[model samples]
Target chain A: MDIIVCVKQVPDTTDVKIDPKTGTLIREGVPSIVNPDDKHAIEEALRLKEKHGGKVTVLSMGPPQAGDALREASAMGADDMILLCDRAFAGADTWATSYTLGEAAKKIGYDLIICGREAIDGDTAQIGPQMAEHLELPQITYVRKVDVDNGKIICERALEDGYERVEANLPALLTVISDVNKPRYPSVRGIVEAYQEKEITTWTAADIQADEKCIGLDGSPTSVKKSFAPEPKGEGEILEGTTNEVCKQLVAKLMDKNVVR
Target chain B: MEFALNKEQEMIRKTAREFAENEIGPIAAEIDETTEFPKDTVKKLGELGFMGMTVPKEYGGAGMDDVSYAIAVEEISRVCASHGVTMSVNNSLVCWPLQKYGTEEQKQKYLIPLANGEKLGCFGLTEPNAGTDAGSQTTVARKEGDKYIINGSKVFITNASQSQTAIIFAMTDKSKGTRGISTFVVDTDTPGFSIGTIEQKMGIRGSVQAELVFENMEIPQENLLGKEGRGFGLAMATLDGGRIGIASQALGIAQAAYEESVKYAKEREQFGKPIAKFQAIQWFIADMATEIDAARLMVYKAAFDKWQGKPYTVSAAMAKFFASDIAMNATRNAIQIHGGYGYTKEYPVERFYRDAKITEIYEGTTEVQKMVIAGNLLK
Candidate 1:
């Protein structure tokens, strides 16, 4: 029942400010936080480990500062952590990121690998499925609930409308949605233990024996030419009046616009 | 030397703040109006490891340093002062002293559940006769062959009625005066122990204070805490550390009021513009901001001194006295900033006003704090 969770550290979207002139985010003052949905993935993995007797390991591929996310994961009851940080891992797209993660995953007894369905910053939703492809294991996406039995995993996956149930055998991957479980805050005791006791192992490119040609910016095929905030739109009308008057006005306006007959 | 909190401390503060805002903030006003105890929230606080933030992990506590405890208290108090006091009395006055002085057997029986927040506990020091002068005790405990009979009553005891455990002090030998006091770990369910009455308080209504009566209450000799005659020192030691918690709590109340005041002042207009345009309003806001920052620094300093094993009695007293005073002033100003609306229950400033006064009076009074500070200076 050994489980591995892949987490990422991203700029706190709430605090981010964009430079209108440069059409880029001002990263200097903004704080870095654990990717929001990734916490749910960690929670799901921990819950699974709790029910079935096993250890939970959190692995992350980012800059050295990503240790903050790994440390946070540890505080949330991760059994151990590995920070896949290296200069060579810079400028990675989702494809290269998953390949590096797959290399690290090979070293562990990964009965199940869990990840957030999508990173909010990139919103690619590709890393989970890509890692699964690299590992040659079945992968479940948008998982909201998980139930495990003897070498069998049942995942209730969320879809565009309603949801669907999917099952996979041992050595599978799951990409969880934020709706999966309410992530628990790191307990005070857990925080102290994480800081005072746990050791977070840091791995470089050579440590994981990743192929030079298939790692870092060299391997990333995707490139962004420009980024900018969309132009603001005018505030929408409230259509405020008496309930009957507002409804009548709304209907007249919609009919005038040919929206409703 | 560093003003910044460590990473772990920040994490604890963030967790407490998030819990307070998301879970406690919505119901805080309602709880104040009804004076209903938030038992479920308190239990959640315990499960979150906030009830015993500074206790060591071995004793089923958070194992955080005193500074972290201060941050936790301040953050919790910022939202609901009721929860603040409940957590404060548990961590500072009960679990702390229990960890320090309790025998291994006592720690095992009482400290485990208390530190883990599985059970709630209270300190029974203030009584009918004893308030400012804690040495004067009317409660008597006469030793029997294998047990002691406790008689008399405790008043204004936080969590008295609801707590499962209590660390009570009583006169073991009347002739020895203050030295006669002995501390005992009393289980609230023991026969002859009763909750007399719940006090109708002006503020912090969520966590009510109650009277505890001990009539012919019997307990085993093993329940004795520290030494028989050394209870005064133990009690004072506990109260000294307790000051840091209360100070932090006061800082939280003041911080909350200050924030509310700014928000109100910004949107509230009097003469064609926001009231914030007036120098009078701006000055009050400025003073509150400055005082809160100073009080916060003092609290962290006291907590840091305690963590470093320095003699922090004077600093703790200073922090308690100054912070509580600021809490009272800031809440009053918050109400003033809101004008007529502040006096009404429609806003939370009125509740903050009521909660602020208690901080200056509890744990140790402002006068008591001054005396402690003066006494230390004269020494």
Candidate 2:
């Protein structure tokens, strides 16, 4: 099966810094990493490619620097990569970003689409399902396992209370969580081959036939008004006891506070 | 003049860092405490092309440059110095010389497997009496038709018992002194070959040292490495590259120590304030960061020079000497920074402290490195 995995490069939240003056992130010195959940998505894609003998292509819509993420995907065993980079795509929120990727996807449609459940930066968890809607395909969210046999695709999706198995025809999109699988590090040979031979096809907005009205900040409906760290909550009590004792005391305290049973 | 690592080098660094963090970090302390070699992870490292990173792709290697090898060593050593040395020895000592001097058949037979990390190998140059003065080796080899009867014992050899093959150095003509030395690719399972004592070490305990005794051990003449008299020069040249690996290892240890101290000073409190606020602690941190930066530049310079086929002996020695000194200094201060916590095994810094000492002593001692540098300078 031909697979297209969408990925993004985000600033490492572990070392994030904020600009107090502008109420925005200070990204000058921050390290950029492939989105964590997207790494799992790639792992799943690679695993699928390994199993049924198919091609895996990674697609991304971001700045030119996002090619780093694409190269990383290739090193992790993607057969091809397409990077949608254009000044017209800057300052795009989820709507505009998904629209651009939707256009790119239409231009380079695949038998399957894979994405991370959510981006740590936005935490919106909307892009994957939004892109699926734009492409007019069904999506399985929070997928922990993917199985393809015959002409059908099967997924086990994680839910809050339990998990459900979902089946769909070929040409489907999946948004996976971290529980899917651990990503493998690229081998030294893989890194060398990726840089030496792989070409990261850069697609401008016009190349993907993206609508000017549906890209960049000009296309987004929502706008951020302010940004700041949330107020620090006071520390809660640390309950230390045996497992059974801790469970009894935790239940008793919750009952006393009327928080839960 | 460029300071930034290229994209490929950066990726290798990131890959090594992630692998070291995920696979080696958790078990590093446990292995050090138990003195158990992480055979599984080490073999995986080989499969990942770290064993013979500098060797060409045709030779079953990752086809990376010396610079990448240096980066890999530094990253692995950051979490586990024992794994670092194991990789360094395979890349620098065993695979390196064989690639440079071995014949086509020899390359196919030995270098391929060694580079592939399919088999472990050791360099048997340092004996009981031939530590600093390697030319004074007491081992002897007598040629008999197609075989050489070797007789001697090599002590303080790293990966001795674990290695399946060894580059054994012995005297072919005792009258020629240094020129008498001959190197052979001897299988450790040779009939008369026996593994003797295992050393109880201070640091890098996971990668143990052992003694190999050869009593009339028969090695085929085709197993000879390079020319008979040229063995010493090959060994010396191999060490020139080996020192870069050692320097990178030391840099990793120092970096680990430095990072631990910074984390400690920030969280550790005194007088109801973080200890990092104190000028004494700040000064130590500053010194450590600056020294690490300088040492890294030196190490990278040597690695680059080696890749470019330039003269890098003095630079390697300088890097090795300086980096190992900084390692000892930084680990000592890291323990000082943690006060009591760093002294205990609970913190990884104690193991880092133990691992740092070996970098100065192995490959070449600090004094040997200085002599090499001074000797080059005199010319």
DockQ of each: 0.83, 0.76
Residue A213's C-alpha lDDT in candidate 2? Answer: 94
Q: Output the worst ten-in-a-row residue range by lDDT, candidate 1 chain A.
A: A223-232
**What lDDT would candidate 2 get against the real structure?**
0.91
Among these predictions, the greatest DockQ belongs to: 1
| Global lDDT of model 1 | 0.93
Query: How close is each model in CA RMSD to the real structure?
Result: 1.6, 2.3
Chain B TM-score of model 1, please? 0.99
Show where candidate 1 strays beyond 4 Å: A236-246, A252-261
Model 1: CAPRI class: high
Q: Candidate 2: give the clashing pairs.
A: none
Error of 1 at A235 (Å): 2.9
